[model samples]
Target chain A: MKLIIFPPIPSILVSLFVFLALRHFLELRERAPRLNWLLKYLWVLALPLLLVVRITGSRWDTGVFWQIDAVYVVLMVALAGVVLIRLRALQPARTLLVALAPFALYALAKVPDVFLDNLMVFSFGNPADIYWLFSIAWLVGGTLVAYKQQTLLQQQRLEHELEARIKARNQELEQLVEERTASLVRQAGELRETLEELRVTQNQLVQSEKMASLGELTAGIAHEIQNPLNFVTNFADVSTELLGELREEQQRGQEADPELEAELLTDLEQNLTKITHHGHRAASIVRGMLEHSRASTGERLPTDLNQLADEYLRLAYHGLRAKNKSFNATLDTDLAPDLPLVEAVGPDVGRVLLNLFTNAFYAVQQRREQQPGPDYTPTVRVRTRLLPGGSVQISVRDNGTGIPEAVRQKIFQPFFTTKPTGQGTGLGLSLSYDIITKGHNGTLSFVTEEGQGTEFIIELPLSARNSPAPTPGGPAVNPAPQTERSSG
Target chain B: MNILVVDDELDVRALFEQRFRREIRGGQLRFAFAHSGEEALDYLHEHASEVVLILSDINMPGMSGLELLGHIRQEYAAPPPPAPPQVMMLTAYGDDDSRRQALELGASDFLTKPVDFVALKQKLLQLAAHDDAPPL
Candidate 1:
């Protein structure tokens, strides 16, 4: 190695830089990768170029150049063939043939060089030395390429294993999703079953409520009739006694003064008058109660809208006031004077108006609570007007908390109310709806704005059929709950 | 003997006044009226010694007839030298519950409305007669 002189250090550095730079360039464009033939063949050029630089510009002998040249040729041919074979671009035979081309050309040129060397004088080392150097270079470059290819195959296997794991995980995830979907479907079925059970229970509860209302009505009747009965029996007994006294006085007329006779007779007459008056009063009360209890006569009677409205408005207001001392609001009534009879069920129309007025009052009261001040001044206005189509329009408007948009659709639904627990039955509007539409052949509707106010409108045609209001044991028989709660 | 008629009904006052008119004018009986249990209790508080009997209706608006009975039994327990004032209860309901409660609260008699005025008059007359009898 010393005889071969110092191995050109700058050449080694420059050649390595060029080879690594080209390999990195190919790697960067790995997506569209081509064979890195330039990377392999670069060493072949570098060895020769170094030799030429030593030969032409330095004091190296011609024999040394020839030996180096032969070693470079054989090493280049062998490494090039290995690179071609590793690339998988050619069969072994073709790669061997292509790799031998440069050596073949060198051999042909050597023939002429040997003849020239015979004529002109130059010294070279033994042929074995060139073969020895060529063997060393070929061994090193071929092993490096083999090692690099082995590493690439190992990395490829690792990537294949990773891909298989990912595929398996994805399949498991899909199975889990399918199972979750099945479980969700099963739960939905169970929920539907529970819903059906709830509906049945709700129906039973409604039946119980009807029975309870009947009980309350009976108790109320018993209490109400007691007062009139007291008067009736007392007055009747008093009259009988008075008549007996008058009879005795008449028997004593022989001894009695005319004045005493007249006074006794007058007292008996007055007792009779009181008995008649109280008897009639008791009879009328019974009549009113009977009318209230019986289902409608199913006949259309001329209904008075204003009188009904006025009576119930005062009743509902006073009723609420009686129950709740804190409740107060301004009530305004606008009745069209001389309004014609609607020819509808009187109680049914009365019920619709009362429900509207109650809801209006409730709204204003709730609003007043949320924003309390002297200036708040909650007001409810009830208006009745006859439309051109022979329909009566009764509207109850209140300046109170309005119907919420989210709950508006459900307002008329049975058992739907925004009132706090126990304050409402949530059936008022629903029953009113049934009475106006199904019971009286009328329409019930409302308009509302959040936090501002609400207005309920009831429209009844003048010549509606005489359908009994639902209250005298219609669907309310099973209405199960809200009727006992309703004051109207 | 003084009698207290307690009821919220105005008609009750007129009816009682007329029914006992002969006795009242003859000085055989005196009648005092109170509109509610509270009024009855107030009148009795002032004139408890003079009143010989109290006939109270059960369901007055203020203090109930049963409540008045409790108050009278507790606060105005008449001494036994003379008979404790007899208390009769009247109720529109005439329920077993009201009857039991009134009796338990020391009501001497329980009557349901419309009460038999004849029976009531006879009972008062007997009480007057008992008062007239010689002391043991």
Candidate 2:
């Protein structure tokens, strides 16, 4: 068998470099598994063929030796081309070019030997030196490729770690926001509960104050009605006796005197008149009391302000008198003669007037006790006037110690009072103010001179009868123009 | 027997006068009227010795019947004019507080209006009998 001459070391070294670079490049790539596997195993076949060509030196046929050499070179070059194309996207251009260096050197070394016939043109340089240089070049190229692959692997690992840390931090931040939102919702629920509790407590206080005022009026009402009732029964009894006497005289037949009969008849007639008058008085008082106490219908009615003020003034005066018999106050009422009927809730307005009158009486009574003499005459005056604007104003004044400068600002506030704790409910002025302002769309204000007297004025619109009734705790139909005016 | 009727109502005077008209005409009983406690006091000062009984209403403008009873009790504590004036309290309210207070103040009796004149006459007759006066 004939062998062909071939430089075996360069061929082997080039094969080794391509093999190492191809293996790493395939490892880096993760797609086209069947193709990558076939390309990588082809090196096993090419390495053996290369060693066989080098051992059989020119003893083989020339065509067969060259064909073996050409086949292995073609296989290795095909492997490098495939690897370069696959790793093009994954690796830098410089690293890919270095990977191809040994293949190019192999091709250069063989080309000269193949074209020139028996031309040992470079016989001056030993073939061993050329093999060593090519081997060293291949070793350096393989090392560089290996180093680049290691760097790319470490970079990929670091990127994966950074992505994992970011995901974990995002989850933690979501949990923190969720916890804060839940806490805020819980606090809002607690605040709503507290507000409801306070509203209930305020409602209870308002109810209790109403009951207290009713209690204060009961004694006076009883006394006022009882006086007329006494007269009613007594006159009836006396009339019965007179009738009996007159009948006895008439039954005496011819002895009965006409003058005595006529006198008895006259007495009977007088007694009946007295009885009727007292009965009417008692009934009127009861009717007034019932009207004041009935539940509010929340409807506007045409009401005579003069009569309402007069009735409440008398009621309040009698109530104070019933409590202490020695307590005296002169009541002066100046009612407008042609005052237009006011559009108001009758019972609600009555209550406000009663409260104001009661407070006035109390103030005067207090001042009377403090500075008593014939000189200081306690008096409460009520004056009703028709303003030019379609409204009416009622003023309640007292000759008594007025409100202090410091406490006047809080006079209409609920649960604020100058009276001894048990004596006053403190809700009187506040409720009265609300009734006049919110219930009737009227203004309730006061003017006071410290130590002299205080006058509370209530101005109610007369033409608001057709307007919608004010709903409880809702905005008034027309806000009072003077609502913001502070009273002193 | 001279009796003083004290009340705040003006109509009480006419009612009492008519009720005891026969007795007044027959001279068996005499009725004097005063409008209030202060007027009653003035009347008592003038006719303290002649007054045999005082009927005063408990609820009045100036002074109450209980207070008047207290005043009378102090004034006629150890008196000797036929007899110390007996005070009867009259009130519209038939409450325990007023009754108890009237009694505590040495009131001779407590009456609620409209007073039963029949019962009142019987009581007055009983007192008149004790005083050796003729009953109407």
Candidate 3:
């Protein structure tokens, strides 16, 4: 039987086209086993085989066919070896291609004698059909295996993509959680700061309240003792005078009984000295108490209003803080630098400022509790400025619960208080009023708004009937005569 | 010279009598006790001619020494005697308010008590000497 070979030009052109196709699909992307090995690779083998046989002319007698077959076998074996070494990835389809390439080359060299005779004569007959069945079964089985492997690779790729997406999602969730936690931490920090402020305020308030109650107790004790003290001092002097008379009688020799008079005089002298000593002691003690009970208005001197206001503002803020543990407020002060020192009782002015500041803080703190929010900031501000008139205006202002209209008129009356029992003496504003207006000849007034806050304004004259410069180690003496007013 | 001692305390009268016993015996100084300002005024009216000095406490039960000082200034100090009975006010408080008020009310002098009896005696002697000399 004769073998049919395709012409060289057309076969070569077809082979070149198939080679470019293989380069485009098989060379670019390593597809699944079905396409890479079972289908596309067959084109690689079949086309190469066709070229080898066509170049060799399918005539082994020329000896050129044998030479070309040998060369082709060498090239195929070398290509297979290089591919096998480079493809260490261990894919079943690629591994099979490398393994079969040399065998395919050798079979193409002998296809005319060995494969063509059976295909031409014994092809399509009943006997050949049996052979085709075996080949079909093998092809079907290989196709099945290739398809299964391809399906598995696709499944693996989908699983890999799902895993990546899940990892990305997890990282995003973790970042969100971290941000939330940080915000919570920051909020907690603010709360801690607020709590710390409250604690400081409470400590200061309690301390001031204790001092105030103690002062009240001291004043009460001093008042109670003053009357008895007067008697002791008076009687002691009277008794001493009696002793003097006895001495005078002895000097004049007027006693009817000398020995009896001498005994009585000696006893009276001893008792009088003791009484005088104790009487002076009591008197001095009472004097000290009187000094502490209130400002000795007679001792008014030039005082720095700004410095005084600032000091008492801090003191009052701290004082309020001590009383109320959960109360806190921002304190701000602006005292004029150019304020000339005004004539005032320093302690009295201090007390006035303290009263005003305490009231301001209380108002703000009440407002804060009533309207609870981050926006609500409790605050007390103290400002001092030299007014156009011959006076310094000191104002203690607060953004707080201001005086209600109904009770405004009663604020300055003695025994009137808005604070709960034991919290206030009810005499603070009245006494403060007296101190400012009467003690220092200052105007004590207020500017307030209901449900907002209050600002107490105190205006003191710069020149308050100039007092005498203090004499060294002596009590304050009015160098000049002054008119008297009702010292409230 | 008759001196009126006006105070609320009962012990003050005995104390004054004991102290001025020598003076009283010598007839140089005479002390009369009056417990209240009103009583002192009553005594003053009765012995206005004899009394040479009035030492009165400012604070008292019925009438304050200040009120009594006003009475004495109006009734006694006006028709000045040859030796006008010097009115000295005694007080427990040393503050200028009371002192000023006492002096304003025609008190001859102001003294804070637990009185210095030595000073009081000296003041008394000075007042007597001044009265003898002439009215200022």
Worst 10 residues of 1 chain A by lDDT: A479-488
Cα lDDT tens digits for candidate 3, A355-443: 78778877888897899865776878889898887778998888888877777777877558989998796667876776666566666
After the best TM-score superposition of candidate 3, give how far the Cα of residue A56 lies from its true spot, in angstroms. 15
Predicted candidate 2 versus true structure: per-residue lDDT over A1-488, tens digit per residue? 22223453345456666565656554634645666676556657666665676676542345445555555565566566666576665554335556556655655466445444333434327674466367556746765775677588668868988988888898998999899889999999998898788778866765666667777887777777878888898899899989999999999999999998998898889889999999998887787777666656788888988988987787787788778666776678899999989888887888899899999988888888899776787889999999987789999999788887788778887778999969998888888888887878788988877667889899899957643465566632223232223234
On a 0 to 100 scale, what is the lDDT of residue B100 in model 3?
A: 85
Q: What TM-score would candidate 1 get against the native? A: 0.42
Q: Which residue pairs does candidate 1 place in steric collision?
A: A206-A480, A209-A480, A476-A479
Query: What share of the reference contacts survives in each candidate?
Result: 0.26, 0.44, 0.19
lDDT of 2 by residue, B1-136 (tens): 8899998788888898778878777776788999888789999999868999999987765555666787788787764644578999887767787788888888889998878888888888777667764444
The alpha-carbon lDDT assigned to residue A473 of candidate 1 equals 35
Name the lDDT value of residue A179 in candidate 1: 99
Count clashing pairs, candidate 1: 3
**TM-score of decoy 3:** 0.33
Which one is best on lDDT?
2
* Maximum-DockQ candidate: 2
Docking class for candidate 1: incorrect
